[model samples]
Target: MTLDLYRADLGGRTREWLALHPDERRRRSVQACATKDVEALWSLTEAHLSLYGGSGLLASPHTFSAYRTGIRQFSQYAETQALNLLRLTPDDAQAYVLALLAQGRKIATVRGKVASASALYKALRWAGATDTAPFVGVRVPKDHEHPLTKNPPYSAAVLRRVLGVVEERLLSACGRERERLLRARTLLLLLAHTGLRIQEALDLTWEEVHLDEDEPFLTVRSGKGRKSREVYLSDRLVMALRLDRTLPRRRSHTAGMVLPFRTRAAAAKLLKPLFERVDEQGRVRSDWRGCHAFRKQTGTRLYEALHDFAAVAEVLGHADINTTRAYVRVGGRRAGKVMRDW
Candidate 1:
C-alpha cells in the first residue's frame, strides 16, 4: 500500500512483504509444511491488507489485530489436531465455532472471531496459498447484539464537560502551549461533529480541509472501504479548525497533512488528560469513554435530527447502513413517542 492507504495494523509486515521476490513468494508456497503454510498465508494476507487498506475496505487496526488473533487461535487448534493448513476441514471449522461458543463469548464476539477465521481462509484460497476455503458456506449464528448497547454513547452533559475543558484550554492558553491545546481541541471537535473515525481524521491533509468555502467541510480521504466522504463543518467546529490552522508550526512535515500528530497513539496521548478528567469527574458512564463517544454522539444526534439512516451512514463512512445504525442510541424520547398512544 502507498502512504495514503497504509494502516498501522500491518506494522512492519509491509517491508517484509516488499523484500520478498514475487516469483519466490509464489514458488515457495507450493511445498508447504504446517509452519510454512501458515507463514505463506500470512504473507499473502499482508499483501491483500495493503490493497484493502488502500480502498478503506479494511476495518480499524483493532479489527485487523482481531483477524490475526483469530489466525493464531486457529493455528493452535491446527497444532493440537495435527492438521496442516490444507488438512483443515469443514468439521474443523465446526469444532472451532463450537469451541468459541463453549467459551461463553458473547454471540457477537464469537461471530467476529469466526468471521476473522473465514476471512483468512478466503484470502488464502484467493492467493492460491491454500487448496480450499474451509469456512466457505459455514453456518454462523446471527448475533442479536445491538451496537448502541456495546459502547453506549455518553450523555450530552458528560460530553459537554469533556469537551468544555479542551475549549477552555484553547481559549486561555498562550504561545506554543496554546497551539498544542488548540490542536487537541480541534481533534475533539472533529470527532464530535463529524463522526469520522480516528484514523480518517488523522489521515487528513490541508488540501482536504475547506475552511473558506461557502459551506465548510472536511474531505475525509481514508474512510472505511476507501470511500471518501465530506464531513460538513459545524459553525463552532469551523471556528476550531480556523484557530488550529493559525497556530504556529509545531513539527516539520510534508505538505497537505493536517495534524502534526503522526500516529493514532500520538493523538490519543494528547487527549488522555481529557479522558482522565472525565473519569475523575465521573462524567463517563458505565462503559463509554474517550473519542469514540464523540462518534456515537454524532451518530445519535444526526440520526435524530435528520431522521435518515442512509444520511447518517454516509456521514459516518459506513459501507453498510446497519453499521451506522449500531452507533445510534435508542433513547427514551423515541421509545416514549412510540408508547405515546398509551
Candidate 2:
C-alpha cells in the first residue's frame, strides 16, 4: 500500500526481473494487466529502469537510490494530501512542488524530487498502471544562481596545510589508528592528485590501480553515468600508494579494495578532523566541501597545466565540458598572471 512497501517488494523482485528474457518480461507485463496484480505493476518500474535508465543494461545503484528517495518523498506528500499516485492530476503534482518549496527545499533538490516522481510515472505508464503522466510537464523552478560562485576549489596552500596535519597525526599514531590514518592520507592524496569523486575513489580496487606502470594510472570502472576512464597518477601519489600497499592490513579487511574504508561516510568520518581543522587565524569557514574540494583542486590545476577544457573533461570523466569548467577555478592570482603576460 505504502511506497516504502512497494520499494521493499521491488528490491526482492529485482534479481528475478533481471534474469527474465525480454520476451518473457513483455509477457509478464501483459499478464500483470490481465490479472490486476499490483505487485506485478510495481515490477514494471524496474523493467523501465533496466531498459531506459541510461546505464545500458541496468540502472546503477546510486541512480536507483536517488529515484527511490524522490519517489518516497512524493508518495509521502500524496498521502498527506489524500491523493492517489495512479490517479494524480497536474494540479496535484504542482501542489506537491509548491509544498516542497514551502518547506524551503533548494531548487535543485526540488527538481531531483520531481524527476524521481516523473520517472516512476513513466514506468507506471509502461506497465499500463496509469494512462496519464502527471509529472511529465510539471514546472520545477530554475536555479538562477551562477555556478562558479558556489563551492570554490580548495587552494594549494590549504591542501598543503591539511596534508601537513595528516603527516603530524601519522607520526604520533600507532596500531589500528595508525593504519586508519595511513589509509585516510592515501585516500586524500588520491583525491587531490586524481580529481576523483569520492564514490569513484572508494569504489577503486587494487586490480584497477597501476602504480608500477611507466605511465602510472588507475581505471575507474563506473563513474558518474557509468562511464569508465583512466586517471594517471602523480609520481608522489604513486610512491604513497606503493608505500600504502606494503603496510600490513587486518585479516578481516575486504579482499581487493584500494582504500580500507568500505563506505563514503566512513572515509568522511576518518578525514573530518583533518579537513575541519582551524587555520592560524583560528577562523573556520562555514563552507567546507570536504573531499570534493580536492577534486576541484585537481581540475583547476589540470586546467592550468593542460590549458584545454576537453582534456580536463576527459581527465575528470565529465560527460560535458561545461561541468568540467565549473570545477576549474581561475583565481585572482592566476588571472593576474595571465593579464600581466598580455
Candidate 3:
C-alpha cells in the first residue's frame, strides 16, 4: 500500500511501513539517521509546520503537497553543501538567498525558497527533532502574499470541453470505475460554476447541501483555517450531485462530495495503473499530474468569463485580493491571453 502517500493524514503509517523492511534494523541507528545531516534537516522541517499552525495546510492538499515538495528541494540543496540544520549558520541561509539572486531569480522566487527552509526549522522544533532552534538569528518575515494572476477564468467554451470530457466518462465507465468517474465529473462541474477549491469540494457532506427550497446552496462549514462560507449551488449542480449521494459511500453514510477515488495522492499512484489497465498492459510515464490541475483549469476559465479581478477573487476565496490578482501575473500578459483561449 502507498502508506507514504498519506504521511500528512496519518503520520506514523509511513514509519510503520518503513519498519517492515529487512534493512530497517541497520538503518535505524541514530548515527545513520543523522549521517550527512538528515537529522538536522528533519529538525528544521518540523519547525516550519509548527510556526504556520499547519492544520490548514495539512488538510488542504494543494498547500501540503507544495510544502512537502518545496522542503524536499531545500533539503537537497543543503545536502549538496554538507550542511546540518542544527548548525545552519545565518551565512549559509544568506548565501543560499544570494545563489538564487545570482541565478537571476526574482525576489519573490528567492523568498519562497528561504521561507521554505525556515518553515523546516519550525516543524523540527515542534517535533522535538531538535533540542534547540537551528535558525536563531535568521528571522522569517511575514510571507509575501500575492494572488494568482496569470490564469484567466475559464471561458464558457473551455469549461464546456472540460466538463464534456467528464460527462462522457460517466456514461461510458462501468461499476466502481464508473461511479468514481461520475464523482469526479460532478466535482469538476461544480467547480466550473462555484469557484470552490478542490479540497473544499472534497469536504462536502450531504447534510450541508440544501436543495429543498427554491434557492439551493451548500454550506462550507470549515475551509483553510476553519472558515465557513455559504455558496449558492447552480441548479445543474444541485440536480447532478444526487447521483453520488445515492451510491454507497466508503466512509460517509449519505450524499457528500464524491471525489472518493482515494487520498489526494491517489492520482499519483493511479496515473500508471489506469493507463495500464486499458492499454497493452504496459507502463506509461507517470507525469506529475493531480487534481489541482483541474482547479487551476476551472479558475482560469472563470477569470476569462468575468473579466473582473474582484469577481474572480470572490469566486476563488482569496483572503487577500492581491492573491486572486496573481492569476494575471503568472507567465505574462501573453500567457494570460492564452488562458482565455477555449
Candidate 4:
C-alpha cells in the first residue's frame, strides 16, 4: 500500500501516534513488531521519520515520498520470500542486494533501494521496535563510471535555441497563447541563469523577489533542507522579469506566486512543445530534461567561468561542495587551453 493509503487507514490514529508519550510509543512499537502487526509497524516507521529523522527536524515531504517508494519495493521482495521484514537477518539483506543485481538494476538504483530499507530499519530501531540490524555491512556494488558522464549539462547552443524558439512563438501568438509563451520564456531564462531547482522557482512569490535593489536578488524561503538562501539575479533574467511584469496576471504585485503555474507538470505542459521542435540540423534532440537541464547548464557555466566549487554551491544553494562538484563539466576546449599554457 502507498504511504498515504496506509495513513488513511490509520485515520485519527496518526495523530494519536504523535500525541503518545515517547516511552508508550516505544513499547507499542516493540509489541507491534513482536506480533508481526504490519499496520502498527508502518505507523511507527512513519512516526520516526516524521520526528527523529532529518537530524531531529521534521523531514521534508520529498524525503517521505522517497522513503515510501523504497520501502514499497523492499516490501514486495519480502512478500515473495515469505520473509518477515522486521525479523530479517544480515543474510536476507545481502540476498536482496543480489536479487536486485540479478534483475539487472543499475548500481545507483540498487544503492538507493538498499538505503531506503536501511533507513526503515534505523527508524524501527530508534523506536525500540527490533534489534535486528539486517542491513549492516550489506554492500552495494560501486559504479566505475565518472559522475560527469551522467546527466551532462545542456549546451549553450541548446539553451539559446530553446529561448529563440519561445521568442519566435511569442511574436505570432495573441492573448492567452502570448501570456503562456511569455511565462515560458521567463521561466526558461530564470532556470538557466539562476540555477534554482524547479520546485524552488515555482514556489517563488513577488514579495521574495527584489528587482528594484542595486543588485537584484530573490529569497528562497525554504529550499531542500528547509533552509533559506539568497540568489542574485542575472541581467538577462532581470530584463525578462521586468518584461513579464507588464503581462496581466491574476495575482497582485505584492502577493501570490511569481510563476503562473503552481506545479512542475503544468509548467512542463506549457514548455514541452518548445523542446520537441526540430533543430537546424534536422535532428530532433530527444534528450531534453525539461527545467533541470537549465539548472545544470547554469552550474556548468558558473564553474567554467569561476573555477570555484564554493561559488557554484552558493549559487545553486547546495549545502555540500561535493554535490556541487558533480554538476560541473570540464570540456576539451578548456583542457586544451590549460595544456597549451604548459
Assess every candidate by TM-score. Answer: 0.76, 0.82, 0.62, 0.81
Task: Encode model 1's per-residue lDDT on 36-103: one tens digit a residue.
Answer: 45555555665566555443335566556666776777667677777766667888888888888888
Model 3 gets an lDDT of 0.57
The CA lDDT at 129 in model 1 is 56
Give each model's whole-structure lDDT: 0.72, 0.76, 0.57, 0.78
Q: Write the per-residue lDDT of candidate 4 for residues 153-250, one digit (tens) a residue.
A: 77898778878988888889999888888888888888888999888888888788899999999998657886788999989889889888787767
Ranking by lDDT: 4, 2, 1, 3
Cα error, candidate 2, residue 298 (Å): 1.4
Over the stretch 256-321, how does candidate 3's per-residue lDDT look in tens digits?
A: 455555354553343323222222567454222344444555556566666677766666666677
| C-alpha root-mean-square deviation, each candidate | 5.4, 5.6, 9.0, 5.0
How does model 1 score by TM-score?
0.76
Please tell me which predicted candidate would have the highest TM-score against the true structure: 2
On a 0 to 100 scale, what is the lDDT of residue 162 in model 1? 64
For model 4 the local lDDT of residue 148 reads: 55
Q: Model 4: runs farther than 4 Å from truth?
A: 1-15, 20-43, 55-58, 243-255, 279-284, 338-342
Residue-wise lDDT of candidate 2 within 1-342, one digit each (tens)?
654223344445565665667667657766654444444544566657766676734445556667767766666666667676667799888988999999999888899888877877787666555687888788988888745456678788877877897889888999878888788779878998999988888788889999778899999976877778999988888888998898875655666888766676787887777767655899874335777878888888988888899999998899899998788767666889999998
Off by over 4 Å in 1: 1-27, 30-33, 36-40, 48-66, 80-82, 104-106, 126-129, 168-179, 248-255, 277-290, 318-323, 337-342
**Which window of 10 residues has the lowest lDDT sum in candidate 3?**
270-279
Residue pairs with colliding backbones in model 2 are none
